[model samples]
Target: MEYRNLGHSGLMISEVTYGNWLTHGELVDREQAVACVRAALDAGVTTFDTADVYAQGAAEELLGAALEGVRRSSLVIASKVCLPTGDGPNDRGLSRKHIMESCEASLRRLRTDYLDLYQAHRFDGTTPLEETLIAFDDLVRQGKVLYLGVSEWTAPQIASALTVIRELGLRSRIVSNQPQYNMLWRVIEPEVVPLCLREGIGQLAFQPLAQGVLTGKYLPGREAPDGSRGKAGGRAPTFIGRVLGRPLLERVQDLIPLAGECGMSAAQLAIAWVLRQPGVSSVVAGATRPEQVTENAAASGRTLDDAVLKRVDEVLGDLVDRDHGKTAQMMAVKPSWTSTTP
Candidate 1:
């Protein structure tokens, strides 16, 4: 698999990162989850991403168990914090207590002494930014986390954090930002990409397939496939519902033929499209089955020429969401710290 340095950091990660967000403990059984992880390894994927809040920490446990026999030095394992893992008031946010406790809990669950990369799952509006950054810096000093990252953070938030880091001379600097980026979601392109490019932070893009919408499986005027994520009846139905409108589905169908011309499935073409962006370091893709893992991993190292790239824009014209304000809107609507758990 193709590997890229995470932003300006010396560490390298596979372009295709296997992530278990909704599928590890909630959607698939342990056996299937293990099989998918194995499939990712077989396809040369050395980066694995998970979050402490995924399946209430079971996802990390499953991933750790799956990677038990593999050489730890050869893999890059990353996880996130800042979401409620319990019902207590201090169970969430980026406060020093939460960050320190969460990192310890994550290390225990992942069966690793330190995380290659540790990220804040979301911006904690309630916590002081300095407190958050200092706490993360302490982790680096303690050797529990090697690199710092943030997920779904706006450009301004990132800039503020960087300023604090530089002024305080923290031991660690932000190396990556994980955001929802795909063929349909282009919100990060307008603002986040430019700022990250200037600051030397890379993007670990998530949902490169728009949660399977770009896979061309959910057709217009049809109920979601019986066993698909759209019909999985948990968080998937709600999360994937926004992009399932008839108009969007119809636009996705237009790209299927274009994908064939490029010698890729609709999903692979969608992932490659995201990798072509200016500051992307990796595309984090989730899977339910082993074959799906293998298929998604193949998108790594494949470059789309200018002709195919232009055709993609022509086909997806006006359907893309490029508004930079959407990032703020998303943060505003995120589940309150008191509401979410594991």
Candidate 2:
């Protein structure tokens, strides 16, 4: 696997990070999840990312067990906060109490003393940015977190955060922002990417395959593969529903020949397309099976030429979600028991 420096920091992270999002404790059983993690390690993936709210924290437990014997110094483990994890009013968001408590809880569950990177899952408009940054700075001072990041934050929001940190003379600036980026989801390209590049922040992108829509497995007229995200029920349907349609599927079908010319699978070509961008530090790929892990891992360190990239843009023309406004347009995540969502 290829490794890149995370923003301006001296730390190195694998270009293909293994992230347990919809898999692990939710869609796949413990045994399958464990196998997938092990497969990632075998493929030389040293960076692992998850969130406190994923599977309500079972994702962390499974990851901890899977990496029990590996030397901690050799891996870069990351987790996030800012989502509802319980019913209590203080159990979520970026409030000082919640951030501190959530960090401690994540440490205990991950079987580690400090996180390589701790991210704010989403911007919390309900909480003061000062309170959130102060809490994170406190964690850094206390040696519990090594670096900072945010996910799905807008350009202005991220700039506001930097200004706040500078005004307060905080310990550090954000090193990365995690966004859903793929051939179809170019929401970050217009504004967020430019700001990050100028501010010395890197991007750790997720969903490089558009929730498996670019994998060539979900055909236009055929039923979704038995266990794919298109067929997933419960909270998953809330998100994956956006990419399920004949037009999107037909556009994906057009890219198959491009994959053949590059001597790669459709999924690999899709992932390589994301890696072509310079600001992206890593592509966070989630897999339910060991074979999937192996296949996605190979996409790392591969470069796509200009002609292929131009053809990709031509094929995905109007189907791409380039609207900067759509960056945060998805349904909010909430505690299963809470009446309020964010």
Candidate 3:
């Protein structure tokens, strides 16, 4: 697998990183989880990304168990906070208290002393950026975290944190930003990608297959397959499935033919498309089964020909044009894109 530097940091991560999202704590059992990790490692995937909120921390623990014998220095591990871990009001957000406690908890769960990257899952409007930056800096000083970052942060929010980091002389650098980027969702390109490239921040994308939408698993007219996330319903699953939105569904279905023309699976084309973008250091995809890990890793070194890339742009541009009059600026990086196109 290809490896790239994560921003300007000294650390280098695999082009295709492993993620423990819905698959780890929900879809796969402990044994299957271990197999997935093994498969990824054997395929040269050296990075593993997780969040504290995934399966209420079970994902991290499972990953920890899976990597027991692996050399620590050979891999990069990442996890996130700012998601609710309990029912209480203080259960989430980027308060210093939560950040501190969350890091400790994550360390324990991952069976590691330090994290390669610790990211805030989202912008915490309730907390001062200074407070969050300082707290993160403290973790770096205390040797609990190697680098700090944020997920789903706006351009302004990232800028604000950079200012705070400079002011505080924080040891931890904001090396990476975890955002949802995929063929269907180019939302991050307009602002996030440019900011990251300009500021030298690496983009680690999630949901590159648009939650299997680009896999051609969900057809235009047929019902969603059994055991798919679409069958789950509710907000989170809806966010992943994107099946509830007819417009996005049709657009994703339209791309299957293009994927075929390239002699690649939709999943392969979707992931390769994300890798083609600038400033993307890695794409974090999950695996519920061992075979899936190898399949995704195969897309690592594959590049789309210029013609195919142009075709993809035309398809996306057409959608943007047809959805006109709404001003697709803010919706340019629509969240649904991650679920359908990437």
Report lDDT (CA) for all predictions. Answer: 0.90, 0.88, 0.81
List TM-scores for all candidates, in order.
0.96, 0.95, 0.89
| Model 2 TM-score (2 dp) | 0.95
- Give the residue spans of candidate 3 off by over 4 A: 232-236, 243-254, 260-263, 320-342
Clashing pairs in 2: none
lDDT of 1 by residue, 123-189 (tens): 8999999899999999999999999999999999999999989898887999999999887677888
Candidate 3 lDDT, 287-334, residue by residue in tens: 777988998998888878889988887766544322212112322324
lDDT by residue for model 2 over 287-323, one digit each (tens)? 9889999999999888898999999989988777777
Better of 1 and 3 by TM-score: 1
The reply for model 2, stretches above 4 Å from the true place, is: 332-342
Clashing pairs in 3: 182-342, 183-342, 184-341, 184-342, 187-333, 208-342, 209-342
Worst 10 residues of 2 by lDDT: 333-342
lDDT of 1: 0.90
RMSD of 2: 4.5
Taking the candidates one at a time, how many backbone clashes does each contain?
1, 0, 7
